[model samples]
Target chain A: MAVAHAANDYRLGAQAVADGVYVFSGRNEHFTRDNGGNIVNTGFIVGTDAVIVIDTGPSLQYGEQQRKAIAAITRVPVRQVYVTHQHPDHYLGDAAYADASIAALPATISAIQTQGNALADNLYRLVGGWMAGTQSQSPTSTATPGVVEIGGRKLRLIGTAGHTAGDLMVYDEASRTLFAGDLVFHDRAPTTPNADLLQWLNALDQIRQIDFKVLVPGHGAVVRDASAIEQTRDYLQWLSTSLHTAAEQGRDMVEVMNQPLPERFQKLAVHDEEYRRSVSHLYPAIELTTLPRR
Target chain B: MSRARAALLVCALWCAGSLPAHAATAVDTPVDPLNSPSWQYMRQRFLGKDPMVFDARVQVQMPSAAEDQMQVPVHVSAPGLTDVVDVLVFADLNPLPKILRYQPTSAAPDIGFRFKVEQSTPVRAAMRTRDGVWHVGGAWLRASGGGCTAPSVGTGQGFWQDRLGEISARLWPQQPGLERLRLRMIHPMDTGLAAGIPVFHIDRIDMRASDGRLLASLQTYEPVSENPVISVDLQHSGPVRIDAHDIQGNRFAATVTP
Candidate 1:
């Protein structure tokens, strides 16, 4: 069990899920520097020969401190750093791990290169000095999706699209641990800024079939069963239905935004706020698809 | 660090060094250094050292966050400006943020319209209320970011292509002798915020009679939104026409007849 960290602690306590498998669990909360920008859960697999780090956090400070956390565990050289998605919190710290060969999808790489600086600038404004010395860094390698053998562990690469244009989930055959990047937000509200809800629903189905003992989500606590993925799907479906119905009814954005949050999402941190922001980001695309040309 | 990162770091340092120099000068100066050069040139061309007062009486009502950065609703009104002579609107972050140079014909002129807000920026409205005192009111609208630089998300490719210089206008008599003229021109209004997206926006517009009697000639900057919408209340209604052109030398003209 991971020790409950007080707010403002940058030091991470890696919780052991199984033999040689550990996760640096982030606070199931919003992105704040006091929490060390630990708004996303990242994983590392220590093998006999090497270590593979998953999803570096938001900034240079985070990457540097996370490196220290890794040092406390095993000194196995980090073979590759997989940036699971395009969001600033996931890939902006690739610069901090400049030594490691950063790997991401070719599309995600392009996105990070094109929109990365703007994302960094936005994060700088959002988190202030937490982004200091951290500039945008695109991935170093666009490795093809396949089974990546790190030391002796077999990581079956699963490519899923929905939460973003490219979402990567690695399932370790040996450990039965699934590293589900922003695809599953566990208990917290999943972000849908660039989501295709239909595809997101489909992606959840793919995640469900994977027989994994431990499921590490991008933003929340480790999932023990399929309930977390189902919760995410339910939220996405509700959001999609709400947006589609509002568009069909010719309801304006203000009216759609004021719609009360469903009882299911009430338990998530920042659920009300994320729902409001999601409505702003995703509603227009939904409206565009449904509305006839003027 | 690579050579590129090192050079970037040097440039970052130089920018940081110059920021404090500009920071002290910008206390209530209503200026963003990144967009200062164009602002200075525009200031020299438009109003030079005019006495400007920061006033709260003049209400500049605008959204806190623009759902669509391309079309931000802005309403500027001075309730008791019976002798209003001039009004100006501008944004600090736009390439040529100076949106309007208005000479209101009505003694009590109120503007309620929508325009582009490129980034999270202050939309300033300056009014000259006959006394020659320029009362400036401003409201900061949090943008989705990159209005001027982003292509129209509502339209597909070739959406603005061949559609440039296209003018749509409606001139109708509303109140006996008064006429309401609303003009919309199709343009991307790119603010140069998006990568590889250059600044392309309608630079100027003139609403006039067919005989060349100018009703209003608005000198605009880059943050004028895509498909710029302008409405003017005219004291007289007759054969009216509008001549508009972007910075790219695309010309459009539309005439509304009785």
Candidate 2:
């Protein structure tokens, strides 16, 4: 199906969550040709001399469109782009940020180098023509954890794992805005194709201690408080516990996929699809652990 | 059998018998039944010239939509057929279409396992009865495709290497005379379709009782999911031993007690 040129454009708009901190909140849905694979939240922080992009969008067109949107707000050229993790949606747009220094955690960089192409291929199949010009782009540099000052603005990068092998959360010291990356998804069900639920819960605990006024999740609308983190943690905990219980009871994958979700998660976007995907991603290992050895 | 049921059976047998002679090419003919586009070719390849019918007695269960294309769960059972000699399972549109050949020598004909679907296709399970007739059954599965070519998540990180050949199994008591054996093996059933990765997958699994009587055997293919998990119900069980091997010549053995 051919998308109209008008609909092809992401039409990304920057919503200011805090002073000089703008978030391009994405649709709370899975990747599709209609959405142009723009099912991720990417943001930029405008500093006096330069701008720091939190994460890139899904494709080259998205990244270019995002760059134009950022320019509409500030002429400060993007000095650095921080990829939150190795997931395709977050990094496939790195090609458009060729002028800026793209950085990620070491593990995430390695993952991108190895599995990025495969992940990109999967997305191309899922999102169809929207992923036409998209390709996997490796990070240009390693993002070391800790505070770094650029253009008179200080940002703290917290290196953690759980969502994937490496998740980088950027904290804007000036605006007290924490770009929680995929570590904290608000109103959107978390994707666990490469997740360690226990580690993800620990990462959430780490995020809980961060002193930030505004939290910019990797997806969904920007939030102000710890509710988003709590939501992610609660959902992950319930998912882990339910999978383990299912394994202990000798339930098959199909049965586990069909398990009823808690009422609280009924409102979460893509809950059914994400839950089934998570079961396929994690049930085998859980089953291995729960099965008896005689 | 009832008069009408026996007559319908005879008609089905006659139709199946006349398929090869007639060389039927129709998509929905009784001989070339099932909604799959590749049923005719698959029937000829797997069942050869044997008489076959789309029998409701052979039940094949698969999700209508494959949430994870790389690991779609499937279950097949022919409880109504008593003298089933062999069961063949396959996907019609997969690049690697043949999935497995299961022989329920001493175990029940029911089995549950996982496999990969490259795209939206019909997955079929055909059971051979004592009369050499193939009872076919299947369901159409919708998927985004690319399951076989994509490298497994565990393989890139070397996660499966350390736990390779490790088998975890359990025997659960069911009803009075039956027992369910659920087992999982740690191996990335790589299809060799991905770049830089060779095809390495478990190809054979034999289940035996403690007394050395062979219960069931399954010959699998690369389309089987990584770290395959299978459940089989046994007619008689105390302790069941599982002997398996992959394409790389690695052998794994495990035993579970009831």
Error of 1 at A43 (Å): 1.1
lDDT of 2 by residue, B167-220 (tens): 888888777767888988889899999999998899999999888899999998
Say which candidate scores most in lDDT. 2
Best by TM-score: 2
Interface root mean square deviation per prediction: 7.9, 2.1
- Per-residue lDDT of candidate 1, residues B133-192 (tens digit): 466556667775656656665344768786776776555566666676655667777666
**Residue range A1-294, candidate 2, lDDT tens digits:** 245445678889999889999999889998887887899999999988889998898888888889989999998999999999998888888888888999999999999999999889888877887776888988999999999998888999999999998999999998899999999999989999889999999999999999999999998888898999999999999999999998887777777887889999989999988998898789887888868654
What value of lDDT does candidate 2 attain over all alpha carbons?
0.86
Q: What residue runs in model 1 are displaced by over 4 Å at the alpha carbon?
A: A1-9, B1-115, B118-140, B143-158, B162-186, B189-224, B227-258
Residue pairs of candidate 1 with colliding backbone atoms: B148-B190, B148-B191, B149-B191
TM-score of each: 0.64, 0.83
Task: Specify the CAPRI tier of model 1.
Answer: incorrect
* Poorly placed runs, candidate 2 (over 4 Å): A1-7, A292-294, B1-28, B31-34, B48-59, B63-71, B77-86, B105-108, B116-120, B128-135, B142-167, B185-204, B212-214, B225-227, B243-254
Worst 10 residues of 1 chain A by lDDT: A1-10
